[model samples]
Structure formats: C-alpha cells, structure tokens
Target chain A: MSAGTGDSVSLAAAGPILFDLVAVIVREQGRLSEIDGQTGDGDHGVNMGKGFRMAGERLRAQGEFTLPQGLATLGDTLLSDIGGSMGPLYGTFFTDMAEALDDTDRIDAPHFAAMLKAGLAAVQGLGDAKPGDKTLVDVLVPARDAFDAAQREGKSFADSLAVMKAAAEAGLEATRDLVAKVGRASRLGERSRGTLDAGAASCTMILSALADGLVQRLHA
Target chain B: MNRIINDPEQVADDAIRGVLLAYPDILAATDHPRVLRAAKRRGEGKVGIVTGGGSGHEPAFLGFVGAGLCDAVACGEIFASPTAKSFHEAFKAADFGAGVACLYGNYAGDNMNVKMAVKLAAKDGLEVRTVVANDDVASAPRAERDKRRGVAGEIMMWKAAGACSDEGGDLGQVIAVAQKAIDNTGSVGIGLSACTIPAAGKPNFTIAPGMMEVGIGHHGEPGIAVMPVETARGMAGLMMDRILEDQTFASGDDVAVLVSGLGATPVMELYILYSHVDAILRERGITPRHRFVGNYFTSLEMMGASVSVTRLDGELDRLLAHPAHSLGLTVLGR
Candidate 1:
C-alpha cells in the first residue's frame, strides 16, 4: 500500500466516492442556487441535488456497487431523470469516465488521468463552453489538465489528485470575475460579472469530493 | 409556496398530467412522458413542427401542441430545459417521413438540449432542422441580435412555422418561415412582480411594490431598467417604443401584435395595455393586421406583460391568416 508500490484501490472500494460527491452536492444545494439566482435561473442546485440523491439511493440499494457501476448509475440518472443543462453535461462526463475505467480494477495515476481526460472531453463535446465561458467547463478543463500535468511530472496518484482539487477550486473562484458567455447568464453580459457561476461552483465541489475520496482510498 | 400541487418537486409533472387530462383531444403523450404530441397528425408530406421550453410558461411549450401548430413539444421542469432524451422523443413523435422542424427559443439550456437531441435523432436516421427564436429586443443590442432572449414572441414563431407546415411546406421551408417570423419580430416584457418556483419556496427575484422591471425575461432574469410603475397607457407606450426602436415599422406596414400577460396579470389589464398598443400603432400608421391580446404566454404567476410585434410581408400575412387550433391560440381563417 506504499505510495510507490504502484498500488490501486479496487473499483468496489470506490463506490463510497460517489456517495461523498452526492453528500457534497446536497449540502451545497442552497448556496449553488443562490449563486445561480444572481444571473441565471436558480434551479442548478435543485436539479443537481435531485439527480445526485437519486443516484445515491440506487447505489445504496445495490449495497456493493463498484466505482464504474456507481458512476454509470449516477450518469444514467442525471441524463434520463434530471432536466437541465447541467444534467447531460455532467451525465456525459461521469458516463465517459466510467467507460474509461470500465476494464480497470486498478485506478493508477495514468488510468486516473485518462479518466479525467475522457470526462472533460465528454463535457466539452456536449457543451459549446470553453474555459473562459464562465461555465462548468472552466473548472473541468483546468482540473483535468492539472491532474494530467502532475501525472506527466511523475507525481504520485495522491499528489495528482491534490493538484486537481486545488486547480478546480481556483478555476471556480476565477468564474466570479468572468462575464458569462454561454449559459443563461450570458444574456446579462456585464451584469453577469461579480458572481460565481453556480455550475462551476457545484462542479468544483464534486471534483474536490472525488479527489478527497480517491486519496483516502489509495491505500485501502 | 402557497400553490396547488401534489408534490413540490413534482409540480411540473403534475401540471403536465393536468394538461393531458384537460386537453386530451388536442394533446397526446409520447413514449417519453415529458413529450406531448398533437393528437391530430399532419398530412403525409407536410413537415412536422416542434417546440419546447421550461414549464411554468403554460400554454407555451405544451399548450401550443395541436393541429396546425406544433406537432409535438418537449416539456422541461418548472424553469429548466427538458432533457435531451425528451427532445429526441419529441422529434420521434413529430417525424413522419417528412423532416422535423424544431422551433424553440434561444436559451443556453434549450440550445444544448436541442443540440444533443438533434445528434441523437440523427443517430436514429431522423432529419431534424431548427429555428431558434431571439425576439426579445431588450435582451441584446441589434449588433448582438443572436444573443437576445426569446420571450412571448416565440408564439409568433411557432404560429408562422406551424402554418408553413400545415401548408405542406418541407422542413427547410418551415424552418425558414419560423426564422423569418422571429427575425421580423421584437418583444419586450415589463415585470410588476416576481414568480416563485414551487420547489424553491420563494420568488427567485424581486421587484418593489411601486417599481417595475422593464424588459424582464421569462424566468425573472434582471431587466434593462427598473422604473416606477406606470399606468397601462404609459407602460404600453414604453414597451412599444422599445420594440419599435429595435425594428423598423414603416407607414402602412402590416404588423401582427401579441400582448401576453405574465401569468398573474389579469386579462382585463392585458386588454387595457393592448388598447394603448393599438392606439400607438394606429397613430404611427402601422396597421394591426392580426392582434392577439391575452394570457397567451405566461411565466408562472409573475405579474407582468410582454408586447410582441412582427412586421409582416405577404407570405407572413398569409401564414397569419392560415387556420390553427391549439389550447393557447386558435385561428379559423381570413
């Protein structure tokens, strides 16, 4: 279980990671909606909470879901049940990540990096948003790139996860200064500034929770 | 939230259920529960017209589903876009050999959902075209017309496209007519109060008792200006002035006008506003060829109204005169 043992947590051991992500979304639901209320319609948190809660319930019912299995369930719930822009975006994200790690029981640094890249691609493929569009892509692109950079620099999986979380937080913070260019807030133009994007904020929370869960499970 | 509903989270679902019960003759449920298709199918070669938006704008995204109108509608959550799957389902429901035309507003969620839905439909070998309505004049400058929001004017777009489809136009022709309708239209909303999403349990935004937000959006998005509430005449003049400024309505030009109450506004007030609107149009020598004044489009229980004016040509005039049947709007003939 040493950092350099090339060790990996079993996919079954990673199910709680999605549970952690769901908890994070549920806790921040009000804050996320308040942020959205500043510019766009304030339903981001409600929709995210509803989707994540549904996924959590399904996962709990399964009792022994694997990482990819849990991710697939969550993605399916969001894609099919949730009705918002964030649903398909994050649904595709988790679905792609699940597919990327489907064949792997060992979640090594390279494999994790590949998963992050796949999730990022899935989000960008569905949304026309770029990094500066003040949308979830801003957090996702940077977080994915940071993880890849840490991996390329020969960092441990734990250290790469730390880097990803930090980058995601910073990306989320940067959205406060950005004028929305893609979502409903984009209609506000300059009025969209001075507020954090609800999507980016929720995305950062999910990414951070995910990173923390992975780090704790690295030695399990 | 002091409202009628079975479940707070299921407000949209319950409302849709009620819509189905109330209008079974005009509406039919598709494979996807969120998608409501017209009961009467179009002719064999006629294009299928489709539109969708978030719920709470009743008689809008769903109420417009009927013969000679939108063939199908993808119903979203209270104020959220419908899932891409729902949009795809609507496409399937509307597709009948002839290609489908998706006529909807220019909102980010709708745009993304429709984009994915089109991709999904393409996988199923269904051809779907789209015409996005961006007629809210105050939402963006003329230079950024594509960035504007589509408000009540979306009804006009659907009407024109549906008429085109009923006339046996192809998908491209329907899309073209819908686009023309929106492009020639300008809309502006004035909000006297805010509406609450039942789930949220409170209004998303606020307007002071004596103040009104001019150019407000459907979902309580901030408007261009906040001013003291004015009489119906004054409000009509302000809204019409903004709409007229956005587009040129020349002397003797035929125009179709729609004055829609923003949910809680009474029909009496809407007609009062429309009287001023009609007077202003007459003073400017802009003939009101077709006029619709009612709660045609609404935003939950927000107390407000929107004015939409579409400059019409011979083709558009014909489309306006064409027959339509829907819960929200119905026209017999010239």
Candidate 2:
C-alpha cells in the first residue's frame, strides 16, 4: 500500500494484511477459551477461531480482496456461521467498519479513526453494555479514543497505532477487577471479578493484530 | 464421552441432517443450512410465526416447525444462538406477505442475533416483529425478571403464538399473544447432572452424584439453590412453590402445566414428577387445563426436568386448546 511516502496507506492494498489477524485468533484460540472457561462456557475460542478461519480460507480461495472487501467478507462469514451472540456482535462490528471505508480509496489517521468509531458504534447499538461492563467495549472504546487522541496530538499514524494498541491492552487488563454486568459472565456478578473477560481479550488481540498490520503496510 | 458423532465441530450440522432425514414430511430445508421451514406452507395474508435458538434443545427450535406451529426456525450450535444471517433467512422463509413474528428465548446471543436479523429483514422490505420469552422465574429476582433466561416455558409462548397466527391473527396480534403467553407463564428446573457439548469434548458444568441443582438453566447456568437429591414429590413441590410465588396463581385459576425432562431423564420419571405437580395444582384449587409431559425441550443429556405453568384466561384457554401438529408437540381437536 503506497501512501506517496506520506502518512496514509492505500485501502486497495490493505486486504491481504487481514490474514495476519486471522492467524492471531487461530493461534490464540486455546488461551482465549481458557480465559472464558473461568467465567463462561469456554467456547469463545472454538467459536471465534472457527469464524476467523472460515473467513481466511474463503478469502484465500477468492484470490484478492480490498481492505473493505476483506473485512466485509470476514464479517459476513462470522455473521453466517457463528451462531452465538458473537456472530451478530463482531459481525456487525466488522461489517460496519467496512461500510465506513466503502467510498474511501486511501486510509489515513482520520479515516482509520472513523472506521474504528463505526465498529464501536455498531457494537454499542446492538448490545446495552457500556465501557465498564467487562465486554469488548472495554477494549474497543479505549483503543479508538487513544488513536483519536494521538491523531489530534499530531502524532504519526504508526505512533498513533502503537498508542491505540497499548490502550487496548490496558483496557483488557482493567476488566480483571470489574464485575461483569452483561452477557453470560454477568450471571456470576461478583464471582466474575478477578477473571479477564473473554470478549475483552479477543478484542485486544484483534486490535493489536490490526495495528501491527497497518504499521507494516504504512510506507512512511 | 461415547458420543456418536463424526466430527465434534460438525455435530450440530450433522444433527440437522439427521433431523431432516427423519422428519422429511414435516420439515423442509432452507437456502441456509441452519434454517428450516415447514413442509406445508400456509396461505398468504396470515401472519407468519417463527422461533429459533441454540440446538441441543432438540424438539424445541426445529421440532416446532410444522403446520400449526412455527412456520420456520433458525438453528444454532448446541447451546448457542443462530447467526444473524440464519435468522434473517428464517424470517424470509416464514414470511407470507403479512410479516413474520419472531418468537425466541431471552438469551444474550439470540437477542443480538435476532436484532441484527430484524434489521437485515427490514432492509429487504420484509417486516419482522419479535417477542422475547423470559418465563424462568428462578433465573432472576422478580424485580429483574427481564434478565431471566427463558426455559421450558417458551413452549407455551410458541403454542399460543402459533395458534394465533394459524387463526389468521395479524402480526401485532401474534406478537401480543406470544408476549402474553410468556407473561402468564413461569418455569424452573432441577438439574441432577451435566451434559457435554460435542465440540467441547467435556461437560461444561458438573453436579455431584448425590446432589441436585434447583432452578438450573438449560445450558447448566447456575440456579438459585443446590441441595441433596429429593423425591419426585419434593422436587415438584419445590419448583411449584417458586413458580407460584413469582406468579399469583390463586385458587380457581386454570393453567396449563408442562413437565419436560432435561434430555437424559426417562419419560416415566417425568410423569412421576408431573403427577405431583398435577396434585399440587389441584390441591390449590387451580385447575390443570392441559398437561404436556415428556422431553419437549431439553438439554443435551442433562439429567433433570423443568416445570412450566401458564395461567390461562378465556383467550389463552381457547388458543391452547386449538389443534396443532409438530414433532415436538401435537394437539388434536378437543
């Protein structure tokens, strides 16, 4: 993805990079399930890994995908195959993110920020969970905000991505001390404390993988 | 354990194949593998009735698809919600020009999936309405009833909604009846053992050999209390007390009682438990207008049973008595 040796990347060439994200989820499936087992049914890994792998295989077979096309394909696969709440939740998230970039040819800090915000908004619209509810929101809100803050500070796109990833990690860690107020884990109430939220963990992994992919492809 | 499955991950998919094979006359496959429609479609202008949820409940989601029951169903993985695409497909399959009424349990996944599916269906110009069933009184306190997980009581909601739709009720009428059915119902379960999700390869939760969990959910979600195993009468009395406390079923009230085994339990045991439930209702001057005793809705192999009672009025009574046919339940003209 060429950015004229400047601060943006070409959305046309950013598709294949998502394969890296698929690999991350597939690789960490076990760990994700283990974390969920502490407070949930422990199938988070199996379900998320299954959806991501399916999307990855389909994209590989299709031979080419623009960033928006790839993300849309991934979102559609998850929405179709994964039946859990995750199917709709993450499905809408990526699908909405893809929609935000539909008319854009290049991805810059502002464009990236908009995509992140669209994804987060889609999730919030579907579920009633807020930031401290020990869900992906915990990671997603902070990640998007950090990226926006860094961009407003006039930081480079790469530095903004790093800041976003760090904020996502911090948000994920913050869930361990919070009582779950939504989802299946919320049934545990106080017992849910001390366990890293499975959704938050998955979100962090996704955001980290995304940031790394964008950083690698940023020509400047 | 010794599960007869080809691939653990494909269990849900394979089970659908088997169900289709066994009930070819009653059900037909949709474009989506996870959605099924009734073999005999109804005429246009009548509101369509649809219901769906995670699979392992067997007769629940799919079995309910028949002539006078759900027009279509979206099947999910065991103890999981069906995908939004699947739900949208189900809505399309069920729609016959008068809009579709989506009736389902109040689970987090199902709620999210259904919401997305409704949005998708709306985009396609197909109107889809929904009624979420939350009749398991033991899952949450009375003040938090909305947060309760739907259990066997969902059957009553479906039966009423199905009857209403079959009688040519409009979309709003179908939705209102479904909501009223669930509102007049309450359910609670006693789990004696745990069941495994084929993909998971092990039991997700466990119960002691000599102990039982009261108010346990279909997926082994923890309930209100855990105590030593009790007699059939004892279990019936305990479950009934919780339900009556949640809903004011006073003397002279008429109700429909359904006792469903949680998969592994025998039919004889369900009747044994139902006998006590019937006796308790009669003793309280509450008449049991209808009784459904069997494995209507179930967990994979969890050893337990749930009791559901719907306080019936003139409308609910007439609706419940309406003839219907499905693999999970069947009613003949009375």
Candidate 3:
C-alpha cells in the first residue's frame, strides 16, 4: 500500500512495513472497539494496537532477519503480547505462518497459500471462532477459503491472492449482518445485529496488507 | 466517551500498567505484551498455578494472581482469549516441579487459545493440565451444564485451585480438587440497564428503562427473558427459583455463595440483592458456608449482578478458606 514494492523487500523494508502494519492494527483497535462497544465490552482497538505495537518494537529492534525470522519475531511478540483477544488469534496467525514458510527469502504463490492455510488452521485450533462468530475469523476464514478457491481455479499466485484481499474485504463487510454469537456482543442479542465486528474489520486489513505486498512482489 | 480511560486502544496496556502499579510487590510484568506473573516462581517447591483471560474481567484473571493463587496471569485484550504463546510464557514463569495448572473460565475463545498454549508447553516437557470453570446455569439447561457459560462461578474455581496449590498439593490433585468445585457450581445473572464500553462511545445495548433482562451473561450475554423491571426482592426470587430448579442444593446443604456485581451495579444494590438471595436460600433450609459480595467478573461497566451457589463439602470449604493474596482479594494477609 505504500506504493513501494513489497516483493523480496529486505528485512529493512519489511521491518518498516511490519511496523506500519502493526501500527495500523494498533490504531484500528480503537475504532474496532467502538464498533464492538455497541455490543461488546469495548477495548478492541486498544488491545489490538497494543499487541501490534509490541510486535513493531520487536521488529524495529530485531526485525532485520529473514522472512522466517520476521515471522517468528511476530509469533513470539504476539504470544507474549497482552493487549487482548487478538493477541493469540493474530499471534497464531504469525506463528503458523512462520512455521509454514520457515526461512524463505521470498514466497511464491503456493507457499503463500500454504502460509494462509496454516494460519487459518492455527486460529481454528484456538477455537476463537467459526466463520460467523463475528470475530477475526469472519474475515479471515472467508479470505483464506477464497484464496484457495481462486488458486484451484488456476489463477496466478498474484491474481489468486488478490482475490484473497477482496474476500477479506467482503468478509469484513459481511460482519455488519452477523449478530455476534460469542464474546460480549453475544450478550446484547438483537443489539449486536447492527454493527460490523471489530475483529472482522481488522482481519480484513491484515489480509489486504498481505495481498498488497504479494501483488507488488509478484507483479514486479 | 464517558470512559475513565486515556485512549481507546491503549486501555488494556494502560490498565495492565495500572495493575502493576497497584501490586508492585506481588505481580511483575513479563517481556510479553500485557502479561504479568508473580515476581518469581516459588523457590518454595510449591506447585504453580497459571490463570488468565481477556482484559476487562478485572480482579478476575489477573487479580487472582499472587502468592497463594496463580503464579502468573496472561492478560489478553478485553473479551478476547489470550494467544497460546502468551499462555505458554505464563507456564514457564509459573511452573515448579509440582507441575502447572492452567485455569480459566470456559469461554470458547479462552478455551481454544489456552488449549493451544498448554499443548505447546507440554511439548516442552512441562506437566500442564487444563481446567475450565463452566458454572453459569442460565446459559444452558442442567442436562447440558458443560455447555453453559463460565460466569461468576470462575471465582469459586480459582479459589479452589489456588487453595489446593497453597496446601502444596500436586498439580493433578489441584486440578482434581478444582474439578469437584466446578461440578458443584451453578450461577444466574440479570441486567437492569445495558453497559457502555468507553472507547465505543455508545452503550453495548439499549434496554428500555424499567425493564430487566433475566439470565444475562457476564460479558453482557442475552438473557432468556426481558420484561418489566422487578424489585430487588423479586429479581432475587426469580434468579434463585431458576437456579434451584435443578435442585443443585437441598435442605440443610452447606454452600458457598457469591453475589457478583456486573461492572456498573452499586455495592449497595448488590447487598440488597444478597439479602433477598440469602432469604430465598434460607427458606429452602440451605446453610450458607461462606458468602462473597463484590464486582468480580465484569462486562465493561454494564449494570448487572449474578448469583452463584456452590454446594460446599468440607474440602471445598477449606479450599475456599485458603490464604489469598491478590489485587482485588487479599484477606489472606500472607
């Protein structure tokens, strides 16, 4: 999204990119909290931001490593980060992604898809959600599935993952109709129906960022 | 909005810092985000306990972390279960030769997240066992108690777990002891007015004035029924009657009772509800072994309270009576 290429970007490029991404999530958490506040206990964006800021600082200090290195950094940062619910959900995403792409300098489409799958499985393992739980999975689950579908249709890595971004966007949009079945929003019953889930929105942002990075790299 | 917070996104971090600020002597921050544990694992050769969950449940997941209770608490953001990595970090900080027990409320996110964390830790050769508190009777029927939400009943579970650890029991024994408490517990909650989350700048719900929702959850769960507002006495009777419908407690049964405030409920009102609760239980000839009243598990300042009754055997009474040193609860003095 910075218009700077995301392909084969050095850890230097990746570090700042990671920082920016983390910062966005951190900042967006407040906005997310507001949406959830309509039906949840609030504190969405704040915790989300907190978790990412922790990851960002780690990246700033030690993010100059390889892709796997950066991912492991993110994983460790996420695991220990205490901001809130997103800590593990996002943390699992990074940790699984790290494991999936252990040390690749730049990942192609197949590996990228594998990373996405692993991240999805990790989140599912945490049982933080199903597709309509109105949490991050609402966005991530669909995005991952769409990426898989597009890849199966023989779309190029760049084109297929591009669909992932759209899927994530659509997933985030779909949250507006989902009455929360979990977390604080579930308590509000009908009141929860009107708002888009904060986690879902953030999940879309994360996937979209990854898509932006991949498209830049693959196209270039 | 009207929240007593610095920024919307910084709430959990700021509040976590405040927690460290409040209990400098007992809890210490870890390298991970938002995680705090006892400054040191017991050099005392005692078993260690680790408990945590989403932020905002205050005095709950973290406040219960101290000498006689949990050695570590992995604080996640409010309402979101903590990640597995954070949960594993807590296990390392708290594990003693006696093994570690991961205790928490049985919410879906926390359950799955902590499960992954504990699994990772076990791979590292740490003896880890998982125990969840699921005691809210209002969320499901008696035949389906396992599927109920873990509301105010978590307190009793933590208390029992901490007490077992304090008595120097092995981790398995501690978990077994906690299992007993969880098996005997039942809880019900009600909401008079919906709560407002600070950052969101709007109420989480909009219940009409003079109307109350019955069987509301700790995180502001939807109630089974919402109707005209009932008096404290009527509300107490309603909650008690519903809870007792399963005959969880019989005449002459000794019990440990909890009257918990859901975020915004005033203590004065909680006491009012308690008086009626005690009266209702008394009419059924139940003897309260102990009683606790206060805001334990919250819903981001929602106005509600839950009543929980755990039929107490002697072991549970002792476990409840063990010395506790936490931020919100510290009568143990040790």
Number of the top-ranking candidate, with DockQ as the measure: 2
Q: Model 2, range B190-242, lDDT digits (tens) per residue?
A: 99998888777777678999999999988888888899999999999999999
List iRMS (one decimal) for every candidate.
Answer: 1.3, 1.0, 3.2
Across B197-293, the per-residue lDDT of candidate 3 in tens digits comes to: 4545566556788888899876666778899988899999989988888645789899989998888888899999999999998999998878888
Model 2: clashing residue pairs? A83-B81
What candidate 2 keeps of the native contacts, as a fraction, is: 0.70
Candidate 2 chain B, run of 10 with poorest lDDT = B197-206
- The DockQ ranking, best first, is 2, 1, 3
Give per-residue CA lDDT, model 1, range B116-153, as digits (tens): 88999999999999988999999888999888888888
- Candidate 1 residues lying further than 4 Å off, grouped into runs, are A1-6, A62-64
Which one is best on lDDT? 2
**Which lDDT tens digits does candidate 1 get at residues A93-116?**
899999999777767777787888
**10 residues in a row with least lDDT, candidate 1 chain B:** B1-10
Worst 10 residues of 3 chain B by lDDT: B196-205
Task: Sort all candidates by lDDT, best to worst.
Answer: 2, 1, 3
Q: DockQ (C-alpha) of model 3? A: 0.39
